[model samples]
Target: MDWSEIIARSEKSFWGLLGLRMLSADSKLVELGLTVNESHLNSMGIVHGGVLSSMMDQAMGTLVTAIKNGSQGVTTHLNVNFLSAMRSGELIASAYPLHETHRTMTLRSEVRGEDGTLACISTATFRLPRDSK
Candidate 1:
């Protein structure tokens, strides 16, 4: 889907409130972009870890949904590692599947700053509904 379509699809959701934009998406990878704003900052003036974590989660979930042809799943586990601090500018989060079975899919994702510094990395597993299997 195009960016506008993606935005329209999610505009009323939390991702839209965070200003996440779909940079690109395919069966293998999905990239999401976000411009760091005041609302995303923590008390220390750095981007909050939760913001990055949410981006990674969204990226992984989006990819899994696409791979399953719109079958949605629940995140069973999510592990995030904060690698660097970011104060401003933009961030891009990308995700792809690492493994999958009839009812579970695991994905790896990373978020990088505009300068290409890796800010966060994560892996998540989603459990598809029994009917989606």
Candidate 2:
């Protein structure tokens, strides 16, 4: 399925923005892009950290979803590193599966600004469903 169809079937808040297009997806990777707006800004006038985190989470989770074998999972942990400020404009986030086991999966993601500068990096762990039938 396409990104729009995936969003329509999932609970993704940021999916409402048309900017978030799926550049690619496969059994091991997922990529999404977004355009920052006023709503994404914080008191400092830069993109909010929460928004960045959410996007990172979504990208990483999508990677996990693609690798899983007809099972769903919940994020168990997320580690993020903010390298630079995300200005209000266009940006891209890409994720890839680091590892996957019978009960867990690990993913890594990076957020890049419109200029292709690294804004943030993240790693997430998810617990797979026990009944993965």
Candidate 3:
């Protein structure tokens, strides 16, 4: 399938609201890119936890959808761990499958900072479509 279609579909979603780009998508993984800006900063001038969480959430969902071959799913649970903080520059989230059953998929994601530091680690569970095989 053409990955552009998947990216275009995200243009109107919350991911777009944060200015994230769907950089790449494979059957079992997905990557998103973002450049930190003032709007994404907290009062301390650091990237807010919410922004990191949202990036993980989007990465998990995008990976699940790609794995399902466009049959998307909803997040059943999300857990995030903040390893560090950042003030600016580019960030990327690389999400890959941790496990998958007939009804759900769990993903492990790493959010990397501009200098390639591990900013956050997230694990998310997604409910497969009702008719998913």
| Candidate number achieving the greatest lDDT relative to the actual structure | 1
When 2 and 3 are scored with TM-score, the better candidate is: 3
Best by TM-score: 3
lDDT of 1 by residue, 5-28 (tens): 655878899888889988887779
lDDT of 1: 0.91
Taking the tens digit of each residue's C-alpha lDDT, what string does model 2 give over 34-115? 8888888899998888888878887887776666643557999999999999877788889988877888888899999989
- Using lDDT as the yardstick, the better of models 2 and 3 is 3
lDDT of each: 0.91, 0.79, 0.89
Could you tell which candidate, 1 or 3, scores higher by lDDT? 1
RMSD of 2: 2.4
TM-scores, all models, native as reference: 0.93, 0.86, 0.94
Q: Each prediction's Cα RMSD? A: 1.7, 2.4, 1.1
Question: Lowest summed-lDDT stretch of 10 residues in model 3?
Answer: 1-10
Better of 1 and 3 by TM-score: 3
lDDT of 3 at 73: 83
